[model samples]
Target: MLSDLVDLVLPATCALCHRPGGALCAGCRADVTACLHPSPRPAVPSPPPPGMPSCWVTGEASGALRAVVTAYKDEDRRDLAPQLGRWLAPALRAAVGQDGSARRALHGRGLLVVPVPGSPRARRRRGDVPLLAVVSEAAGGLGGRAVVATVLASTRVTRDQSGLDARARAANLHGAMTVRERQERAVSGAVCVVVDDLVTTGATLAEAARALHAAGAAQVLGAAIGATRRRVLVPANSPGPAG
Candidate 1:
């Protein structure tokens, strides 16, 4: 709603189609929605890196969906965060429902939604990590079943992942993230859903899970708004209801 008001006062073009309108025009909005899978499904990278938690995604990161994510993250089209979060919510809910720790958290402790940490260099360039707010927005829709936490932090600078292959990406991120000492208690015994705006090689999410598990997280799962079309589907064996 605020984004609409902002757009009204300051005209903006659709991130995907460049049509003059709100952050995304109605037609393009439909196109993005069409990108979403009818149900969230497992999306693992081929040769998934070690510690890659079971993962799910709402859509393929291509065309309108990919364009919107790029605009929101790199082009300063922050207004699109709300829409991205809306797209991400169902995938998150599905991950929570399927993970034993997260399912139990629904009635016992509580689910923790942690955004994968971006590189420090990227933070310096962007001024802030946009995924934090995006994750907060998405987790809010979980009906009090989840709490957003920033437990993971990058331990060293890493190169941009844009041009990296799966192995290179895994090596770049390995040993890059850790749970901040002060926040370790928040992760211990928690059921965490590591949220990322997009998943390309699955290396980033895998690295994030490693840190959380090292911090004593009871279980870790991954959720993303979209994933690269290049993925290996994990067999459907979880008992949780499909999204």
Candidate 2:
């Protein structure tokens, strides 16, 4: 497989299980795959983070998934971008709602994928928004109708979110982002899908939605690689169908 070849050349090792082969070996990928569902599911943060937008996730953020996400976000695994980006594709497709009719509509209307902004501090530390590459890759697979746009920017400095509970997370991110004035014209009337690497309290996605809506976006949906299952509330114990 192509991934296996890349693994060999890069001397890859599994970020989760540490198996020597790929950043995520086939076994760990299967673990993530088992939880992936094509349909968009609601990710309501417990206590419900205010301003949180509706979101679809590929898997619960735990075990191998969580470890891999951490490695990508903090451990300088930029090479893992393609692999993680592929993992994020289903959720992006789910957010786009690819039923026959919806697919045709999307092909005509075009899709704009926007990554939720990371703090400048984190951006400097990590070199970029880790989810941007993933979103770009996912957008590439959407034919010629979709494009990745980095339009949101943090409006102020926010503290590290690691120790925060749901409430604190909400407080930390509320009104912390904005759509650039230059991008507002482009955002207007666009079907924007907010992309993120992980969703814990849903604060970040919520904030992204708020910024997009404020800029005149026609509609917004969220896509993520994983979300905290314990924190999110999905309907009917099943992934919700369509966006």
Where model 1 places Cα greater than 4 Å from the true spot, the runs are: 1-8, 231-243
Q: List the RMSD of every prediction in angstroms.
A: 6.5, 6.7
Candidate 2 at residue 175, lDDT? 87
Residues 90-168 of candidate 2: C-alpha lDDT, one tens digit per residue: 7778777743433554687677889887767669976546578778988787774786889898999898988998788
Instruction: Give the 10-residue window scoring lowest on summed lDDT in candidate 2.
Output: 97-106
**TM-score, cand. 2:** 0.82
Q: Write the per-residue lDDT of candidate 1 for residues 119-235, one digit (tens) a residue.
A: 675577555466987898889988756888888888988998878898999999899999999999889888899999888888999999999999999889999999888655566
TM-score of model 1 (CA atoms)? 0.88
Single out the weakest 10-residue window by summed lDDT for candidate 1: 121-130
Q: Which stretches of candidate 2 lie over 4 Å from their true place?
A: 1-10, 17-19, 34-40, 98-105, 231-243
Supply candidate 1's per-residue lDDT for 40.
88
lDDT of 1: 0.85
